[model samples]
Target: MNPYKEIENEILNASHILITAHKSPDGDSVGSSLGLLHFIERLGKKAVIGHPDPAPEFLQWLEGIDSILYMERDGEVLKNHFQKADLIFCLDYNATDRVGPEMQQLLKSTSAKKIMIDHHLNPENFVDITVSATEVCSTAQLIYELIEQSGHADLLSEKIGTALYLGILTDTGSFRFPSVQPRTHEILGKLLGAGVSHHLIHEQLNDNNTVARLQLQGYAMSEKLEILDSCHAAIISLTEAELTRFKAQKGDTDGLANLALSIKGIRIAVCLYEKEGKIKMSFRSKGQENPVNILAEEHFDGGGHANASGGISELGMDATLKKLKTLLPVYYKSDK
Candidate 1:
C-alpha cells in the first residue's frame, strides 16, 4: 500500500484519536491541528485537540477553536484523552518536546500510536509514521497533500480549507517567503475553490489588532529599533517592563522582526523580547545568503527555516542582547 494509504488506514482503524500542536502555538501549528480535526471528522472519526496552550488572541476568531483543550487549563481532560486515545496526530512540530516538558511527559507516557505531519528539518524518530516535508512552506500544505493524495479530495470543506489556508498564509509570510512554490499556490487555489473566502482570512489576520498591541509595536519600532549599518542588520529589543507597560498579550509582538526587515539596506533582523524571565528571540533574514538558523541554533538553543527561526535565552535580557550583538558581526556576511 502507499504511504498515504497507510496513514489513512491508521486513522480509519483507530477508535479514539487525539490531536496536538506545539506550545506557544502560532497560526501554522494551530491551523494544522484544527484542519486535521475537521478532516478526521469528515472521515467519520472522533478526534480531540489537546493544545499545550491556548490559541493566541489573533487566532481566536477561527471557528471550532473553542473545542480545543489546553494544557494550561485542561490538564485532567488532556490526560484523559491521552489515556484513552489509541492514535495521536502531532501537527506542525517535529519533536514531542516542542509541546514543552509537561505535555511532552504526558505524550511519552501514553501507549498510543503517534503520527507526525510536519514541515521542519531534523524530525525525531518517536512517531509511528512520520510525514516530514521539510521543503514545503507549511504543514498545512502537507496536510492538504495528504488529504488530496489519500483519495479523499471530496471531503475538503470550507471549514477545513479555512484553517489550512491560515496555516499556509502565516507560515509563508503571506506567501512572500521563498519556500512558497507553484504547488503551494495550486493547493491554495483548490482551497479557494472550496469556498475558503481568502479575502476574509486576509482581513481577519491583518485587521484585528488591539490598541495596546499597536502602541506597543509603535514604541518598539520608534524607540527600540537599531540599525547595525556595517552588517545591514537591525535589532529590536523589548524588556519585560516595556511589555508590561503596554499590557502585551501573547502575540502582541508578532511581525515585529519582519517590520524591522522591511527597512532599506537591512538584510537581517533580530527581535528579542523579555517574557517571564526568559528572552524570546525571533530571527529573520532577506535571503539564503543570510541564513539565521545557525545563529539561532548555536547561540539561542533554537532553529528553524533559514530565513525565519526562533530562539530563547535563559540569560538576562542584557546578556542575551550582548551575545546576539557579539555573534552578529561574525555570523552574517552581507553581500550588499
Candidate 2:
C-alpha cells in the first residue's frame, strides 16, 4: 500500500511534465491522458499532452482536447516539450513502439523519468516507474487510485471526474465486461459524487454520431456480416473503397463487433476493415470458453484481454477472410 509514495513524490518534484498515449488513440487512451492532465493542473502544476495521433471524433467534445499536441501535425511543439520534460507519463499504452516511429524515437531518447499508467498485459521495461494493473478495466481507474493514494481527493473536480469517467465507461463496455470489479463501481460512485453527470457523458459519447457513420455501419452489418453456423461465429469486413464511399471517419465502426456478438447464436465476433492499406481487426467473444487473445497473438500481431482483443492483417481482405475462416474451428468453441 503506497510503497515509497513514488508517484506522489514524482509529481510534486517534477517541473516540466509531459503526458502521452498510443497511436490511433481510443476512448481509454484519450480519457486517461486528459484525465491525468486535469489532475496535474489541479495540483497547480503545468503538464502538456503529446499524443502520437488524433483521437476519434466522438471524444473531441470533451474539454481540454484541443490542447493536445499530435506528433504527426505538431512535431516541433511536441519535440520541444519532449526535450524539456523532467517527467513523462505514458498513459494507456505499454510498449514504447505503440507510439509509432517518430514518437517512439523521442520516447526512447528522452532521459525524463518515465512513469507508465496502463492496464494492458505484458508491460515493457521502457518506463522507469510502471503502475500497470491488468486486472483494472481501464488506465483511468489506475489514475483514480493514484489520486486517492496521493491524498488528493479534494482535487477530483467535476472536470477531472468527467474525463476519467469516460475512460472507464467505454473500456468496460458500461460495466458489462468481465474485467469490471465491485471496486470499479465504488470508484464510479466517487466520480458521480464529484459531479461526473454520467447521463450527459453517455449522451455526448453516443449521440453525436455523423450520418455517414450510421450509413457505413448499417451497410457493413447488413451486407458484410457473415455468420458461420457450425461454430456460431460472425465476421464483418469492409474494404477501403467502401469506407471512403461512406466518408467513414475514425470511431465510426467502434462498436460494430459488439453488435455482431449480440446475436442469439453468435459466440465469437470478428470485425475487419481496411485502413491505411492494412486490415485492422477487432475480435469479441462471449464467455470464458473462447479466449480471443490467443488467436490474436498467434495469428495476428495483436493481443489484449481474453474476451476483447485487436489484431492486424497485412494480407488483403480476401486472403485474410479465408485464413480467418480456416482458423475459426481451431479457436472457436462449438456449442455441441
* Per-residue C-alpha lDDT of model 2 across residues 1-336, encoded as one tens digit per residue: 473268878988999999999988888899889989998888888999999899988999989999999998999999999999999999998898889999999999999999999988999999889888998999999989988888888889899999899999999887788899999999999999999899999999888988899999899889999999988999999999999999988889899999999899898999999988799999998777788999999999988888899999999999999999999987775753
Highest-scoring model, lDDT:
1
- Model 1 agreement with the true structure over 1-336: per-residue lDDT tens digits: 677778899999999999999989999998898998999999999899999999789999999999999988999988999999999999989887899888999889999999999988899998889899899999999889889999999999999999999999999999988999999999999999999999999999999999999999899999999898878999999999999999999999989999999998899999999988999999999877888999999889999998999999999988988888888988875555
Instruction: List the lowest-lDDT window of 10 residues for candidate 1.
Output: 327-336
Q: Give the TM-score comparing model 1 with the true structure, all chains together.
A: 0.98
Show model 2 residue runs off by greater than 4 Å. Answer: 1-4
Report the lDDT of model 2 for residue 188: 97
User: What lDDT does the true structure give each of the candidates?
Assistant: 0.92, 0.91
Highest TM-score: give the candidate number: 1
Lowest-sum lDDT 10-residue window in model 2: 1-10
Cα RMSD of all models vs. native, in order, equals 0.9, 1.2
Count the clashes in each prediction: 0, 0
Off by over 4 Å in 1: none
Give residue 111's error in model 2 in angstroms. Answer: 0.7
lDDT of 1: 0.92
